[model samples]
Target: MFDLPPWQSWEMFGACFYAVRINALLVLGLSTVTLGELLPGTMMSVKTRSISVELLPSRVFRCTDTFGASSPQRISRQGNPLETIDWTSGDWIAVNDDNGVGVDIFFTLKEAATDNVVVFVDQRKRQFGKFQPCHAKDYIDKLSVCPDFLVARGARFVGGIMDCVSPSNLEKFVVPDDCFILSQAGTELFTALWRIIQRVRLSSPSTRHAKPPSRQCFKAVRKKWIKSLGKL
Candidate 1:
């Protein structure tokens, strides 16, 4: 017979030892396994059975006290200030103040529901390191009020923000308590946002200087994004 590889041999030995140990435990009444289910084959069969687990849905919150209200009151949760901005259908870009530090520009997509609002952060502002402690707190606090999840770039930057916050504050004010979920930015999301911006720029009748992309150029960009995603 052909010899098994060294790693494979060790794995087989480990499995056999585990089985024997389990069987011995069953015989000595040290395990919960029934007398009828003492065989290793029976144990394996039981383990292979499909298990059903129910996951609870995430809690959704209202963005403001009144629906379609232009100015919503700032709410407080666990001693942290939750800022609310006026609802906007177009891209809202905010510039840095005289201090050269300000909130990143965000695009308010739509009201997912009467009470829930979906907001998207500009992927260009992935520079988490550039944010000072006060800036980070301001950014995160604003995100806390969004009823729907916010999509942004830079998973590493998100992790860095989480690391900066204390564990108790993170759990109580940021994650489940605040009903916020941070999703890692994907190529598809970025491409979709880019396409929307391009469409808006070209479709604007007022912008006579804006040039639309050629069919070939559009195809090239699409292919490049597809290839990048495929590599990932």
Candidate 2:
């Protein structure tokens, strides 16, 4: 009963066959797979009865059981309980430029159930972005002081108002250069962010790039952002 998605059916069968071939009778007997189905008229429900076994490529075995709960109960290869994560659709924030004109968007991919931020995404362009695994506080600090800190190592822009209109600013917004490689989950989150930004731009292009109402407004937003991230 190696239940898996339609796409992974072959992979699951392959793993099962390999296990049998390797004479892992104990593993094959202990392993069970349960496929979940949504019950009609329910908000969201999973009907699960037993434990599931996942065989890693290295042949390490892990078991997970949810028993209809939202969080899984995992057992490592050593038979010790493992931590669980419930990742949800994440949120985003928009940062204003130095002169308060133009905006750069950042996103936090988080696990809502565990209150963890897996990574921070900095959207440099429509097609390019970077994900930093640092703590939210550290990332925000670097972003506030120098938005280009990740891309530009030593270069620092001078002047106050002129900085907003600098060609470098435009260049940063448009240039699709080097980008960090993303895991499958990270790629999904990035695609979600792109869709959200596109919708925002379509609804109100000017508002998407508009300056903050006031410096106080910017501060208020930043404070709220930090407070929300503090829980992560």
Cα lDDT for residue 133, candidate 1: 39
Summing lDDT over every window of 10 consecutive residues in candidate 1, give the lowest-scoring window: 51-60
| Candidate 1 CA-lDDT value | 0.26
lDDT of 2 by residue, 1-232 (tens): 2354442333233223332322221212211121110001111112111112221111212223211112122222113335322211222222222132111222222222333332222312121233222221232233322333221333221101101111221212211111122222333332343343334334443324534245554454455344433321
* Root-mean-square deviation of every model: 25.9, 25.4
lDDT of 1 by residue, 1-232 (tens): 0154453333233223323333233222222222112111211122221111111111111122321112232321111226333323222211111122212222232221232223322111233343333543455554322222132211111111212112122222222121122122222332243343334335434322433435554454345334422321
- Cα error, residue 32 of model 2, in Å, equals 24
Candidate 1: which stretches are off by over 4 Å? 1-87, 92-102, 115-232
Q: How well does each candidate superpose onto the true structure, as a TM-score?
A: 0.21, 0.17
lDDT, each prediction: 0.26, 0.24
